[model samples]
Target chain A: MSVLKVAGARKSFDKTQALGGVSLELGAGELLGLLGPNGAGKTTLVRAIAGRVRLDGGTIELFGREITAATNGARAGLGVVPQEIALYPLLTARENLSVWGRLHGVTPGDLAPRITRALDWTALGDRADEPIKRFSGGMKRRLNIACGILHEPRVLLLDEPTVGVDPQSRERIYDMLAELRERGVSLLLTTHQLEEAEAHCQRIVVIDHGKVAAAGTLAELVEATVGAERRVTLTLDRAPDRPLPGFEAGESGVVVRAHVRDVAAEMPGLLGVVRDAGCKVTDVEVRSPSLQSVFIHLTGRELRE
Target chain B: MIPTLLRIAFTTLRRDRVVQMSVFLLPIVFFTIFAAIFRSQTRGVTAGVRAAVVDEDHSEASRRIVAALAEEKGLRVRTAARPEGAPRGAAEVPLDRARALALVKAGDVPVAIVIPAGFGAGFGAFESRAAPIELLSDSSDPVAPQVVSGLLQRIGMTAAPDLFEKLGFSLFERYGGPMTGQQREAMRRWTSSLTDTAPAGPGRAPGRRSAAGDSLSASIVPVRIVDVLGDQKRNPVVALTAAGIAVMFLLFSASSAGGALLDEVESGTLERLLTSRAGMGTILAGKWLYVTLLGVFQVTVMFVWGMAVFQLDLMHHLPGFFIMTFFTAAAAAGFGLVLATLCRTRQQLGGVSTILILSQSAVGGSMFPRFIMSEGLRAIGRFTTFNANALDGYEKVFWREAPLTDLWPQVLVLAILTVVFLAIARALARRWEST
Candidate 1:
């Protein structure tokens, strides 16, 4: 069963249409990634699901219950971690969680345990009492996510949750999200980090200009956009005088490059052809189609753009 | 480097509307308000005092006294009438002593004059028994009563000669039988010349100028001005300044607290809150409560300090003071929230709030006393949330010792303003939900 369903979500701000007939679904325990360039309606779509933005026209359902508007009861089962660090800098990590937890309708009797569990999950247990201003960027990011998940909502929507964290914090955040997925919590996250999405998300949706551009597994997206091509590069000891089919020389003229439909099937023949042409192969490298290449190919721009 | 720094500064100032307004507009507005006040003070245009006259004696002497009071430029005299069974459109009816005293106590009129029965007949008669004319004043209105008292004293000086001639004839009739036409003429001439002449050198008795000079000045008995309300001596300037500064900072604190909404928006906390079970109303209400409480606390601290350092009478006027403080804070908070909702950015809010709050303070008498402002400016001040109402309410409580009922007008205005501003803020906050 779909844990969260959005259909024909439409919203406009003045003359700019932020969301135009956008639709998506998250299955039970699914980890879905949303990718878009700047001003491409990704945040708008997430906000609509979180009930922060009122849609001009659309329907949103959580666990088969249709949400017609952004009301408190409609958003009761949802959790959202916004792009910016939304925790109060003057408040301690525990205090921030308690405030947000109460706001989310967690009973005071139940709030303490949930706060403790959330703090433990985010690995901020030791620093729970410390003010967020004194925390490292990674710690604050963990606390930010912790604040949203204290109520254990059925669906969680995160917007660039780990924008400027160190590598260690990023990995920790990925691990925490993985654990949440294991616990049967559905997740939809928007991020500019293509590698993170590619590494963790079960499926990905690319949105551009208020509409879904593509939605599928990584391989499916790769096949649809860049056609499963593998980029192969072979560093040579000497330049080859003769040219090979569908291959080009690198800037130094010693590196030979080719885009192969199947790297495993073409590497031996390509190496033999280069050897026959009087070039000595010093190094060989092969790269499979990645989300970055697929994203660029589909959106025709960088994520930051 | 110098040129580079200068360019950067100018660019920043030009780019930021808030900075531009604070730097360019605030001083000009303050200067205008204060200059107008100073000019008014130097020109010495005393504000008119509202008073009522109750003539129990319908004689010519009583009528003359009433006419003299009506003619004073600074006094606005209204005849107090018995409201019982009087026609709705009746221009005048006699007010008894009890009714006149009631008017003074109720603060309907700051001062009430009562001409006792037989006062007119007894005028200038050395032996006739008559009660002294009474000037009943509301102690709560310290300043207006003083003005009324001064006007009465001046009226006495003008009526001295007539009183002296009457006294001379009465004494002559008692001692030497009825005076002939020539004797009466001589007495009138002597009394007129005696009043006209300057006192013969210093230290000579003012009454020694003529045989009846003492009796003459003594015949026009000084009006007995009595303060019906409690006499709590207070410095009006100190009270006004305390209230003004308190109100000014209350607006500032409220606006600062209201600006927290923009901060939350920029920080994304508002979006997170919206995504929670709390609705937009809940969020705005929470902010409103915080700002209101902040203003109350701010004003309390200021007044407490004022009491400690400046001897402000906070303890005696606690009830009126608190009522004014609460309403002022509530209105200020509402104003702040409306301001925040109207602007899209913190910079925009800052520019708008600075222009609005400072202008209101200047025109409303938060920076200067409204008494010194021109009628037009005073009218404008009256419309401001603080000056002609909130601050005025505070001054009345602290300096005038006004009762709760007496402060109802100011309280009503502030309460209405608070409701209106809150409604506007609520409507404007819908923009956030739509975003």
Candidate 2:
């Protein structure tokens, strides 16, 4: 069963349409990645689910119960980790956890143990007493996530959780999130890092112009948008003046590229053509269509103009 | 490169609205307020000294003094009062000694002049035992009593100079032996002619060499000064000063504390809080309560310092002081929140709060005594700024030794203001709730 679902979510801000009939769903223990460019409806949808926004026309359901802005109890099971560092800078890491835990309705008797567990999970146990302002960016980011999950929310919404962190920290964060999923906590994450989403997410949803552009697994998206083909490239020691069959020349003319269905079967024939063109092949490479290519195909590679 | 840097600086300044307001608007506002304050005195628009007159001696000499005081442009004398709820054309009852003293105590008039029953019997008897005129005053004004006392002396000398001459001749005949008939007759003729001549008009005596410790002025009127607030209050001015400074700084600290909301908005904590069980109304109430508590603590610290170092009677007035402080802090906190929510950034809040609080302080008797301000500005301060009501309430407690019942007006006004300001702040804060 779906843990959380947003259907036909619509919102408008004066003359600007922020969201237009966008729909998506999160299943039990699933890590769904929401990908979009700037000005997409990802944030608006997240806010609507969090009950901070009054939707113009939409229905958000959690655990098969419909939720609206006035539905205070609906937010009890939901946790939101904002893009910015929402913790107080002057407060200690442990204090921040305690505050957030209390705000999320964690009982006074259970607060201290929960704070201790959160500290250990985020690996901030040793520095929990010091002010968070003295912490490194990666430590702050980890603590930010720990603050949101103190109440053990069943469904979490994270916006750019791993942004502005080093690779090691990013890997640790993904590890922490994986542990949550193992404990049956469903997460719907929004991010600009397509590589991380492609590597970690079970399913991806791309939104453009306040509408859902595509939603499916990596294989399905690639097949529907760009196609299941491997891109091949050849570097030559000299330029070929004549046209090469089934190949396009790059800007330098010393480089050439082509697409193939099976790399093992076409590699030998493609090499024969390079030799026939009187070009000595110095290097060869084969690449599969990735989420980045699929994303670019669905949403064009342009600024938010 | 220099020209490019200059252009960049100009462009930045043009884009910053707070900087523009600070540079251009603040000075103009300050200048206009101060100019009006100073011009009220120099431009001859100063309000006349208000005095309540009670004449128990209804003799010709006492009547002449009252009539002369009424004619003087520098004094507004009230000899009768209409009872409460009376119509505008109702018959005014003559003021007695008790009624006149009530006027001084109630702060209706800063000074009250009472002529004794035997005052006209010995009008100008310089060396004889006679009844002295009594001046009952509320010294908080520091201006009306002195002005009225000096005017009384001048009016006594000018209103009946012939009486003084007649008494001088009688004294000479009694001490220096009887004068000849011809000499006595000539003096009587001269005294009779002196009554026909017009007295010097009530104007400033030109180039009069005045001494600081001149007892001659006091001897002319034979008056006794009575302070209606009594003499037991120690360092009363210190208490008033502390209250003024405390209230002004309380507004500053309250606004600073209220800016924490803006800080949370910038840091995204407010957004996080909104996602919690707490709604927007709950968040605003929390902020208002915190700022009000901070303001109370700030003003209490100031008063405690005054009690320790300046001898302000804080222990005696504890009950009234706390009551006034709570309401004052609540209203000030509301005002602070209003400014914080109205501005978009911390820099903008700083500029706006500074201008508003300073202007309110200047007009609200925090910088100077309200008695010293023109009547128009005082009315504006009382109606527009909460500071005037707050200070007035403190004065009743510390200066007048008033009972708790006297604080209802101030408390009621502050409560209304607190509600209004909080409502405005909440409306302005709707932008941050969503969208």
Candidate 3:
């Protein structure tokens, strides 16, 4: 059964609309990546789900119960790692985890092991005693994630979880999320990290200007966005003035875009054409579609812009 | 639950050197400034007297009397070579009656006293007449002149016993009769009998007005001050300092509450807390609890320091103090919360909180003591929460030493204010999220 459902969610701040009629269904163990540009209402959707903000016009159901406004029970089911760090700078990581546990009504005996496990999962056991103020930005981000998970809620909402984190820390975080997803913790994460989403998310939804422009698995969305055929690129030293059919000259006469039946079927022919063009033929490469390219094609703007 | 918040607040206070200095150390600095300002009155009101002694009589008695006036503590003596050349009247003497009046206009000395040329002849003639030396005093300066006049009067009145005995002995020697030691003792006793009618009149001399003031200034006789704010007869500085502290705490309470607002909003905990099991009222209650305790702690520290320095009678004034402190703390807390709620970020809170606190403290008599402020300014001060019940309470308890029953007026007003603020705060409460 679908445990959490958000249907036709719309939210606004002042006159600026943040979300418009966005819908999602989370079944057990579903790890969904809510992808969008910087101003794509990703944070807003997360906040709305966590009950930190009231949706302008929408219905949100969690665990088969409708949660129109946030209540302690509804909130108890949600675990959010906010974009901004929320742990007290003056508090040690262990104390920070303890506070969150207590806030969720965890018992001290149960709390210690749970905190230790959360820290261990984040590979932060050695740094648990240090105050967050003493931690590097990457460490703080990990601690921030540890805090959100300490409550062990059924539905986890992460907003840009790997933002501003070092590569090592980012991988550690990705591994932890993978483990949680495998363990049947349903997840809804908002991220601009397209690669991470592409690799980890079971399904993807792209939101733009408060509306869901597209939703599906990466392959489905990519197929839906572009034609079945792939585009191949051939590097040349100079552009041939002679007519090269179905060829578009790219930057500095070095890159060229051409339609192809199959990347493998076209690479040899494309290289021969480049050699015949008398352009200093260089390497040949197949251009596979990325979420970034899909987004740019769909929105006509950069993901961040 | 409460202890956790306290630990957070104090830990933040300890960790933040900026807040520590602003809240705690700044007050000590202001206290030192205030102490120094009041300490200026520690010296007698010594106005310079610009006058010439005629020395026409050339008698030992004339020289003796002239020498006495010259050496007078309140008179900063300047001598003119000749009596005729001496500044003709009060205004010419550096700090004489007319000179003091001009000084009041010119903003120089607030007081002056002139000893006339014939003062010795008059003192010698006191056996036949009631009056002795003529004391021309400048009364333009309200406080200083009265002080100078009183000092001079007491000086002569206290010396009357010896003068009377000397005159009596001179009179008795006109018959050329040999006198025994018994006769001298009898004359001394006879002269002492007129001590009751000495100068400065009726009861005790004006110089001995307050025992606490005696050690500081021998000439300054501290008296009941009729306040410009409410026409209440009280000690000016005592009322002012209490008002200052009261106003200052309003700023502190507001700032403290405002900081909490920023932290919650910034950390996104405010929405989480509201959405949790904790009701809006509970959230507000928790915040108010923290703010009130902070305010009470601040006030207690200040009062303890004040008592250590000024020996304030906090024991007797405890009940009235509690009544005043409670409402003051509550009002400031409400004000601060409103400012915080209106601001989106911590930086905004910082800017707006400063403007509100400083402006209120200025009008409410914190920046400068209310006692020194003008009438219209005092009226403006009355509208502010700091000046409202705080000044009244300080005047009643510290200055006038009124009974608790007599302070019911201030207590009632403060309670009403606390309620008004609380109502406004409750009305403005919105169950909102940041998305």
Taking the tens digit of each residue's C-alpha lDDT, what string does model 3 give over A140-183? 88887777777787888888888888888888888888888787
Provide the lowest-lDDT 10-residue window in model 3 chain A.
A296-305
For candidate 1, chain B by itself scores a TM value of 0.72
lDDT of 2 by residue, A240-277 (tens): 97868989988888889999999999888988998988
Q: Please compute DockQ, using alpha carbons, for every candidate against the native two-chain complex.
A: 0.65, 0.73, 0.22
Best by DockQ: 2
Deviation (Å) of A115 in candidate 2: 1.0
TM-score for each prediction? 0.84, 0.92, 0.63
**lDDT per residue (tens digit) for residues B319-346 in model 2:** 9999999999999999999998998889
* C-alpha RMSD by candidate, in order: 5.8, 3.2, 15.7
Reference contacts reproduced by model 3: 0.39
Q: Quick one: RMSD of model 2? A: 3.2
Whichever of 1 and 2 has more DockQ, that candidate is 2
Clashes per candidate (backbone, < 3 Å): 0, 0, 6
| Decreasing lDDT order of the candidates | 2, 1, 3
Per-residue lDDT of B1-435 in model 1, one digit per residue for the tens? 999999999898888877877888888877887787677556544456667888888886677677777776677677756574468786656667777777676556778888888877766554437567777886545666666665554554454445646765687798889988997788879877865662222223434434433344344444566866555465445766788888888887888889899999889888778777777888888888888888888888887887888877678777887888888898889888888888898888878888888788888877766654566677778875455688768756865566688788888898888888889988988877846
